[model samples]
Target: MRSMCCFSALLLLIMAPVVCQGGNILVFPMEGSHWVNMDVLLQALHSRGHSLTVVRSNKSWYIKEKSSYYNTITVSVEKAVDQKFIQKVIYEIMEYERGASRLVYLFHLIVGMFGTFLESHELLGGFVSALLDDAELTTYMKDSKFDLLLTDPCWGGGAIVAKYLNLPLVYNARWLIAGDAHLAIAPSPLSYIPVTGTRYTDRMTFVQRVNNMILHVITQIQLSWVIKDVYQKVCEKYLGPDCDYYQLMIDADIWLMRTDFVFDYPRPTMPNVIYMGGFQCKPAKPLPQHLEDFVQSSGDHGFIIMSLGTFVSELPADLANEIAATFAKLPQKVIWRYKGEKPDTLGNNTLLVDWMPQNDLLGHLKIKLFVAHGGTNGIQEAIYHGVPVVGIPLFFDQYDNILRLADRGGAKILSLSTMDKDDNFLKAIQEVLTEPSYRNNMQRLSRLHRDQQLTPMDNALFWMEFVMRHKGAAHLKAQGNRMPWYSYHSVDVALFLVGALILLLFTVFFLLRCLCAAVCKCKAKRD
Candidate 1:
């Protein structure tokens, strides 16, 4: 009987499916470029014992659902943020054109700004919108029975679902998560923390520091207002009146930032916020034979890879022409990801495609350099492959990303405003290709980025599982959530100023008393 029992136990141990404490992970990526990170997260979760499901659109190849993985639920939300109203406002701002319709544009800007404010409030407007779409998402949640929710900060819908379901929420911040409170995790030095890795010029003039401080103050105020008004309203509508949206915002069970401590120094990190850098993407497969041959044919004067990213597909014709003209001058071949109408006069050396396997191309040994729009994902790919870049930042966080890359000696920044200048374009490309420092720096950064104990995806998976196993883990959250904003961050500064004033008043009083005494003594002596 004992021998038979042992044999049965051995068989069960060998055959039984790995049970992982009811681990179910629901991943939500931002509208676009989010797939870049989500793909890795899926793989990491699968590697562990967790069953995973991804919720995203089919916007880019990065987010395309793979059947080999657990399950992928496609959620379709109109990319309305990039609507005509928003585009027109952006056009007016970019062109600096004031016309009879300027007031209309200004109004739209105000509305858009207000909308953005609401969008930032994960608790209020953001959450309300998601609750309204509950029918579409609830099915997935119900079927999956997720133990934890891993969502991008931008995906207020996921956050809402997590709150509604009462699941542990882990905010996967792809970029810098800047907030007035210390608990918010930023991925880059653009955050207001005076930490070490920030590249803000040490010898900055007083004027520059003042300007920076003003900018920081303005950003903090705007963000705080948006969170309170927009996010709070949505939270109250869905999560009930008793729900403290402010606390929910701060009580994120875990903050998984896609940033490395090596690249970003002097990190002002909280205990719950973990650095999960390089989770943006995975090492891609080898290039196709034909593509490999084409790259090999270029020899030492390798090809240049150019991409404007998904959001900015419709490049101005003039900009396209300038790019074409610049490519015409290069001895090496050029592979351009152009989504618009192809030009009649194409450069012989240029290869235009609607899309190219960006990661595969970047990994090519024949690819000498990359010309990019300075998107975070693109930057990561470039760094991962140890290829230098010529960054022409278009908008949003691109400006900051390009600046950081340039500061790190891994890329050269070409202001898109001046992209019309052929001299500048030519010079930028030439410098990136010829400069040995750029390559060296990229290689160094690559080492630092990859030389991690756990990849970003691993860290994300670990936390997702951690949250699942531990339940809410709300105890790890900061106490700042309960305190008023003024009391939380600025009370010390306020106290210092108040103390200085009190001390100054006391000193003045003492000086006045001494002077009176001296005058009285003089009068007595004279008498």
Candidate 2:
């Protein structure tokens, strides 16, 4: 047992309930800064005196950022976890992005194709082989004997490792809006729940409900295809065929969902699903001097910050110029987060930089508008700071994120494809800038979000320790995951009932026919 003396100032209060006993935790997070929620989670675990060893891909951003309580081990695979591959995932999304009027159920096809793509991707196979094939790494993990393997199931590697070592697993996924993973794990009521990236609300229309089913069914089918046969093969290759690859996911001790009713729409989560939506958002610190100077100079008009997030590319030169040209017409200064070369048509009002402290800048009082890629984290940060948004959404969940904010009256969507000639794109930027209701509505939501009983990190820490204390939190897991699809959805029961009703109807019809014939014969005899 580690002493509570290792805890820092921020953790002292929360660490009280814990008895200075914590497990050696292994975190296998997907690669990127977008895993911000996961980072906060690991930090909280570390703060509570847990020994954390994170296995990072060479490309992971967290490899260099290891602190006192945690260590990082880097592994180099033949096929690297590159941003280009992630970008390709986005581009393939473009394949289905077209003609939404005709392809209303496009997400199903997108979901189907994407799973196959990821399966065939060299990175997935290479990483799995690299880990399992490396005798030293596997031996080290076995010798160290971690009690818990913490991972976001979004990355299959986490599940693989947990299954291989027969460790207790906790699934973490970042989506205030529940995705297919959430549905599989718990009692996700599809009736009101909007399908991820679909932009529907809980009270979906009949057609929307049908579309939701399409998204859910197709996603599940695609995921299932590899989950058992292909994924199990990977496990069997190394674990001598005894490892139950699918069972690790099913037997997960807890699911730490990065969402809550406070930030998300109302939905019933499972007993084991812990809400930790705003864990990534910290209190804003002072801006860097240059940024502070720039914002201060904007004075009453204030500055608008535009970021397309970490992985997405900057706008095309022509499009960037067009957006810049529009911005030049307004009095407000624009800080655009773009790493690409400066466009020749760059306007005087725009300052293009490689990066900006997104959360800190959003917190700035002088900020007027946030032009963003409509990622959840960006939207969450904007809401946290009570800043209205002008969202130019890119692929994946961005459309849905922007739509939700727009529906809330705090944002306006300006589709990137239409930005070149569309008056609405320019109008949206102006509307969010000049509108008072946007800010007012945003502030109302910000207050509601902050009015929660516990902080996101606290909620996460409590539940994480709860899992640890109880020795894997088995009681909280629902039996629904163990049931077959036919049983879980009650399809088999419904079919049985339908068959019985059909049989009863057939017998009744036959009896009625016989009685009618007997009555006719009696009538003839009496006549």
Candidate 2 lDDT score relative to the true structure: 0.74
| lDDT, candidates in the order shown | 0.67, 0.74
Tens digit of lDDT per residue, candidate 1, span 383-437?
8888899987654556566667787898888765675664898998898888799
Mark the 10 consecutive residues where model 2 has the least summed lDDT.
96-105
TM-score of each: 0.79, 0.86
Best by lDDT: 2
Model 1 alpha-carbon miss at residue 145, Å: 4.0
RMSD for each of the candidates: 5.8, 5.1
Q: Which ten residues in a row have the lowest lDDT in candidate 1?
A: 194-203
Tens digits of per-residue lDDT, candidate 2, 1-527, equal 25455556448767765658777888877666546667777777877778899887776543554567678767776566577766666655543443343254364446555654555433654676777778898899889878788887765667778777878778787531124456666577777787775668677999998888877776566566656645666767767677766665567787877666645776666787777776777778999999898889887999999898878655556676787778777788889988777877777878888878899998888999999888778888888888898887766678777777777788887765565675666788888777799999889878877787898778878876776666688788778878877998899999999999999999999999999999999999999
Question: After aligning candidate 1 to the native by TM-score, how far in Å is the CA of 441 from where it should be?
Answer: 1.4
lDDT, candidate 2, at 381: 86
lDDT of 1 at 198: 21
